[model samples]
Target: MIQLDQVTVRFRIPHERIPTFQEYAIRWLQRRGVRYSNFNALNNLSFSVDQGETVGVIGPNGAGKSTLLKVIAQVIRPTQGRVRLRGRVAPLLELGAGFDYEMTGRENVFLNGAVLGFSRRDMARRLDRIVDFSGIGDFIDAPVRTYSSGMVARLGFAVATDVQPEVLIIDEVLAVGDAHFQQKSAARIRKFRQSGSTILVVSHNPASIKALCNRVLWLERGVIRLVGPVEQVMQQYAPDAPSPFSK
Candidate 1:
């Protein structure tokens, strides 16, 4: 269960890059204020996801899809309006987002569990399962920085989904790793869906969205373009594209 009312997340970016802190300090001392431009990552967004509902978010790059997910995930606070969530959330927003590169994969797993509010003992119980699902094998004891990108994604996805959270927020994570792992991740997602967990997924893959979500929310330029049944929105969103959602 989640709700966002008139949520707006605005960011001020410097007009020009100051390569170093020294340059910035010099500019500051000179009383030459840095110029900034405001960009709205999410503009006046209002939406709700009911418990046990699976919603897919579709949009082009820079269309605020990731921003919307981060807002719901509470990783970024909105500059305006309100966000309300009612459940324990497990977010797989970015590949290896919560990992400590210097730590062993085994160590990072416990760290991530703690971040999600689980104790080390709790993680220990789930350790073997997480490692086995990731298929990282012996590499699980190596530093995370030594892992390949695919390895990192596999471990992260395995840890996040194994929690069986009340709310799951995914952002293009299913596209990572190999096809076998992708299928495994999809199966895990389906299990959560059947267990009545609320899920919000952002993906460019129309087929995955259709297979996993009952509704689709299309966003454009930081605003809602359409929010309705998967087929209804998919038809207008990608009418020329070939997919099962097409008539």
Candidate 2:
């Protein structure tokens, strides 16, 4: 199971800067301080998820849904609180930031696999399958700079999930892929759950949440507004518009 207890993220910024260290030290001695806004991204937020469960997270753009997912994925540390992740975690946070643009996609496969905690031999064993699943075979030997945003997302997701993490934390990167790959990715997620991996999905798309998640967590302004069955959460938070199929 995964547990987050009283997780809070605080950030600080300087209201002014001095060109020289001496000037900054003089200002500090004079009690001149910078103004700042403290934004508590996850305010004492806590949750738990059992294995094989799919938990969908929803909220406004800055409501900290992505922040909660990152806390679980260990991509970002909480300023105050604890996150207990019980297994191997794979996080799909950024589409192309993890890949080296100067390197071929094939090299990225190995590089990302290692970054994801896979051994060299393990990455080698999964490279072909990852390439095949990405559906970017023609460009696998090309530098990622040559691939479109969608293609990079596809390839990155494929590599991120190749090792079959015990806990999958998905952010909003799905927005970059095509519908076909979206469905394919959904199938892959189902397969992962079938193998007993827990999934925590963060997306605003209600259909995507309903299609893959069994439970849901809705956050607003860093607090969990709702947490329950997926259908119930959808009923509570669904936008007035429609899913892609509604058109």
Model 1 C-alpha lDDT per residue in residues 85-136, reported as the tens digit of each score: 9989998886566799999999999988777778889899999999999999
TM-scores for all candidates: the values are 0.88, 0.89
Best by lDDT: 1
lDDT values of the candidates? Answer: 0.89, 0.83
Per-prediction tally of clashes: 0, 0
Q: Candidate 2 lDDT, tens digit per residue, 159-238?
A: 88776789988886655489899888877878999999998888877777888889999999999999999888898798
